[model samples]
Target: MSFPQLLTLLVIALHITGIVVATHAVMHTRTPQGAFAWALGLALLPYVTLLPYLYLGRSHFSGYITLHRSHRQRLSQASEGSELAGLPPSCTRYGALARMLQGTFHPGQQLRLLIDGEATFEAIFDAIAQAERCVLMQFFIFHDDELGRRMQKALLERAAAGVQVLVLFDGIGSHALPRHYVERLRQGGVAIHPFATQRHHNRFQLNFRNHRKIVVVDGWLGFLGGLNVGDEYLGLKPPLAPWRDTHLQMSGPAVMDLQRSFAVDWHWVTGELPPMLPPRPAQGDAYTLIAATGPADPQESCSLYFTVAINAACKRLWLTTPYFVPDQAVMSALRLAVMRGVDVRVLIPSRADHHAVFLASTLHAHDAIEAGIRIYRYQPGFVHQKVILVDDDTASVGSMNLDNRSFRLNFEIGALNVDRAFAADVERMLLDDFGKAVEITGDEYRRARYPRRLAMNVARLFDPIL
Candidate 1:
């Protein structure tokens, strides 16, 4: 055939492949809207969308379930003779969300809420410096910035001092992280690996990211929440300055749960479990459960966990998240909570780090306000904390965001504390945050600039992936 004829044949073949992929999407996409969007893109704009879809369209995570099951079985066997096999009946009031996480309630945990990056990093660094046995650290975004270098120094110091250090970062989240950043730590005797999901079965599937930020020292002290190892997290970055976030530092049996989570991800990456020490004796009496959910789960565990927590609210439900694009179930639960005379409040950022997500969140805020749920935006800076307080005695803090990406796409974790004292602390912290935020009334969206309003609606269409 002539060159022109061959070009024509290639175009025809590409269109046919697009159609086949679109059909497959219609059958396997998680949401009807996602399916329709992909199908339309594939059929009408194959040249632009085909390659991107090949990487971003997948919903299931390969090889994760088998690995997770094996880990769960081993953990079960290890705890067979322990008294903490499960939570007491009194703890069942938190609902069945624990089962979804494959986590058990850990009692006698001393929960200390770290308000922002300064306090969080201070606590984390102190723990790492005090480490005698080992340090396991993980973050989705491990930036090569000032704060990241400080963290690197801390780990290197500990590693050089005869402390074993293992670091795992998300391959996609930290793709921009320089090789030398991690190489220096490895050279200092730190074991570092990327939690990658590019195996043969799920190659090109770049949607499932390990978004949990966990730091465990000596299998006893654990820290986790929204802060990553970046200058932005520390309010050191201009334009996103005065960053507002939250983290938790815990000791006692609860730390073991955090250690287990780290070990699971470590094993997934290196096929070797880190040392699992027995749970330390009870240090203080606070109940906490660690909920780790991801695309590997059979059901939407993160979404269900949020829904259950919202539904269990009798008096109030206050949440802080950078993103607010919740799924149908969670949205319904929020509306129902308001209808049942519960005070449902959502706190998001005034100026978001993500433009499309900020626009989508504005639309969600409008919907929430119409449903009688009060929405507030932090005024001084970005609010990146993932925290939820229910009624008077339940609160959660960790890396999960209030969006579809966190609900179904990311490997997320949350520490749910069911203690009145801890909940009160969370409430007080949120109250201060609310004081710094501006409440969104229905008029806010109605009076938005025409272009801004239009952009919001358009962005809402991308909620499934945002």
Candidate 2:
């Protein structure tokens, strides 16, 4: 065929392909806004939008949903007779959430609040050093920096001591992580793998990230929260230094739940279950449960988790997150909390590790303030902790950010504790953080220069996948 004829045929094929993709987007996209946006782009600009749609458009993960269900069923049967007699009265407040997640609040959990990277790492390292049987560790970002190397050393030592050590990190988040780093761990007898989301039929899907940070030692001790393994997380690197974060250390039956989460992810990656240890007896007085949510869930569990927590608040609801891009349901829950006379406060970072997300968060913060919700910017440094305090008896600390990515796209986990003492510790820590933060009015976004305001509005358009 002549060149002109060939060009015409190719153009027609492209348009047809675009229409087919647009149909898929309309049918499969989670939100109406997202579906509309994808459909419009795919139909109008096939050349530019086709590849991106394939990579990021799908809202559901392929094999994980089936794997998650079967695994959960197996785990449930395995622990049938070991469950606590009943939920504690304090935990009944989150009963709805528990039922939704098909999990129960495990009592007798001993929780320790680890503030900032130093304390978190010290405790994690100490636990690893004492590991007698196995260690299961996972992080979204596993940098090969000072702290990462330190973690590598600790895991290597444990592995050398004949302890089963397994590690998982996100492929995208740690794309820059050196191969030698992983090679050294593997060579040292550690079982390490990347949580590669693009597997089998999901090869084109790269948007779903495993953002959970969890560590389980000997099936008795567990650790999880916002901090990742990186020098910047340790506040050793600058520009956005003095990093602020929170982690939770726990013992008792709850640790088994955390370990279960790690096992599910491990099974997804390696197609085999990791070693499971018998549940230990109660270690303390706290009642806690691990909420693991992701795109594969039948419902948007992460968003619902926040929404339920917000709605349950009667007296006060304070939340801290590095990113503040909450979904409509969560935002609506916050507004309702305000209308119900709940003291609703949100803490975010003043620093911008991600410019687009920060701008979007600023706009959201403005909107929140207008609704009688208080927004504070942590002044000391980037406050990366994801925490929630409800009334005086419930608190949560975990890797789930208050953003669309965490709410609907990423695999995230958090430990919710129903205990006044643990909540008090979180409350005091937040009180100190609030002291260092400055509250912002809606005026901050309203009074911004037109260009900046326009950028923020533009950023808001990407909130679904942000």
Candidate 3:
């Protein structure tokens, strides 16, 4: 065929491919706005949009639902008739969330709030040092920096002591992580792998990330929250230094749930279950539940988890997250909380680790302020903790951010504690944080230069995938 004829045939094929992908987006995209945007771009500019759509258009993780369900059922059956304590009456506020997640809140969980990277890692390392049987660890980002080397040393020591150690990190988040870092761990007898989603037919699906940060030691101690293994998290890096974050340490039956979460991810990656131990006896009086949500879920469990927590608030609802790009349901829940006369406050970082997300968050903060919700920017440094305080009875600390990615795209996990004492600890910590933060108003957005405002508005258009 002539060059002109060949070009014509290729152009026609490209348009047809775009239409086919557009149809998939319309049928599979989680939100109407996302579907419409993808469809419009694919129809009008196939060359420009087709590659991106291939990478990011799908809302669900193919073949993960079946794995998740099978593991969930097996875990449920294994725990049946066990001596797992039931939730206390005061902890029932999160019963709806438990039901939605198909999880149960266990009583007698001892909780410790680990603030900042230093304390969190110290506790985690101490626990690993004491692990007699096995250690399961996962993080969204695992760097090969100072803190990462410390983590590597700790895990290597434990592995040398004949303890089974398994580690998982996100492929994309730790793309820059040195191969030698992982090689050293493997050579030291640690089982390590990246939590990759680009297996088999889903090679183009690079959007879904396993963002949960969890550590389980000997099936008795557990940890989860916002801090990842990096020098920046330790506030050792400049500019965004003095990093702020929160992590939870639990000792009780609840640790088994956290371990189960790690196991599911491990199974997904390695096609084999990691070593797990039976649930331990009650260690304290706190009721705790693990809410693990991701794209494979049939419902938006993470978004619903936030909404339920917000709706359950009668007196106050305070949240802290590095990112503040909430979905419509969460935003509506916040508005309703304000209308109900509840004190709704959100704490976000003033620093911009991600410019686009920060702009979008600024716009969302303004919208929230207009609805009587208070927004605060932490002034000391980046506040990367994901925490929720509902009244005086409930609090949660975890890796789930208050954003679309955490709500619908990423595999996130949080530990909800229904105990006044734990809530009080979170309250006091947040009170100190709030003291350092400045309350923002709609004027912050309204008074911005026209170009900045326009950028924010443009950024908001990408909220779904942000």
Candidate 4:
């Protein structure tokens, strides 16, 4: 056969393979829009779409799910005869949300709300300095910038002081994290690994990302929330300067659960559980539940967490997130909450970090405004906090955003605090944020340029994978 004929045959074979993948996507994609989009692109433009499909198409992390279920079973059997679960009785009210996450609302968690990058990094560094036994740190992004170097130095100091320090960062999120940044820590006796979904069966898949940011020191102190390790997180990056974010520091029995989450991810990456300190007694009186969810979950745990929290709101629900691409169920829940007379408000960034996400969020915000849910855009710098305030006695703070990535694809964590004082604190913080934000009026969408409006709707088409 002629060489050109053979080349044409190879091209046809690739197109056929793309079609087969598209068929699989049609069967497995969780949303109709995603299915149609993938199928169309794959069938018509195999050369362009096939490679992206390999990275972005898969919706399920079956490999991690199997490992998680097996490990949970073993852990359950091991703890069968241990003391009764320490979760408070009121936690049962969280219902299936709590069970699906396999966690309980343990009383006696002392939580300190860290308002911005400065406060968060200070608290984290102080805790690491005080670590007596071990320090476990994980972040979705770990830059080698000034702030990142500060964190590295602190961890190195602790490691040198006879503390066992281990760090885990997302392989994809921290892809640009230089090798020397990691080697510096390892050279100083700190053990570090990158969480990658590149195992044998999941080799071609890169959709799942470990987006949880957690820091545990001696199993007594824990930090989790929106701030990643970078100069940008410190408000040092121009244009996005004065970065607004939120993080929580917990000192109590609940830290054990946070540690467990880190251990699970660590085990997944290293095939061995890092040594954990025994549970310490309760250090505070606030009830806290660490809701860790990811693609491995049996259900859409993060989405349900938001829905449950929204449903639990009797009088108010105020949320702040950098991304506002809520899935159908969550959008429905917000609308229903408004219909039920709940004061629902959503705060999103006014500036664009990801132009596509910002555009998509504008449409979602307009939809929310039409449904009686007040939408506000932070006018100062970017608002990157993931916070939820429900009524008067419940609040959640962590890394889960109001987007599909957080809903199903990313490994996320949320600390749900059921306490009146914490709720009041959250309310005050949100009030200040709302003050800095401008309300999106009903006509805001109508006033947009036609081209920009068209772009937003086009961006919305990518919501499933956004």
Better of 1 and 2 by lDDT: 2
Per-residue lDDT of 1-466 in model 4, one digit per residue for the tens? 9999999998999899989999998998877888999999899999999998888998765566778777666655654533236554445567567666666677788889999999999999988889999999999999998999999999999999999998999988998999999998999999999887555535566678999999998878899999999999989887988899999998887888888889888888888888788657887768887898887877889999999999888799999999999998999999999999999999999899999999999999998998899999898899999999988888899999999999978999989998889889999999999999999886888999999999999999889888
Per-candidate clashes, comma-separated: 0, 0, 0, 1
Candidate 4 residue pairs that clash: 108-284
Clashing pairs in 1: none
Q: What is the TM-score of each candidate against the true structure?
A: 0.94, 0.95, 0.94, 0.94
Candidate 4, number of clashes:
1
- lDDT for each candidate structure: 0.87, 0.90, 0.89, 0.88
Mind giving the per-residue lDDT tens digits that candidate 3 earns over 172-291? 889899999999999999999998765563557768889999998888888999999999999988788889999999999888888888988898888899988976889697888889
Stretches of model 4 off by over 4 angstroms after superposition = 1-14, 74-90, 200-204
Show model 1 residue runs off by greater than 4 Å.
1-11, 73-90, 199-204
TM-score of 1: 0.94
Ten contiguous residues with the weakest lDDT in model 1 = 81-90
lDDT of 4: 0.88
Least well predicted 10-residue stretch by lDDT in candidate 3 = 79-88
- In terms of lDDT, the poorest run of 10 residues in model 2 is 78-87
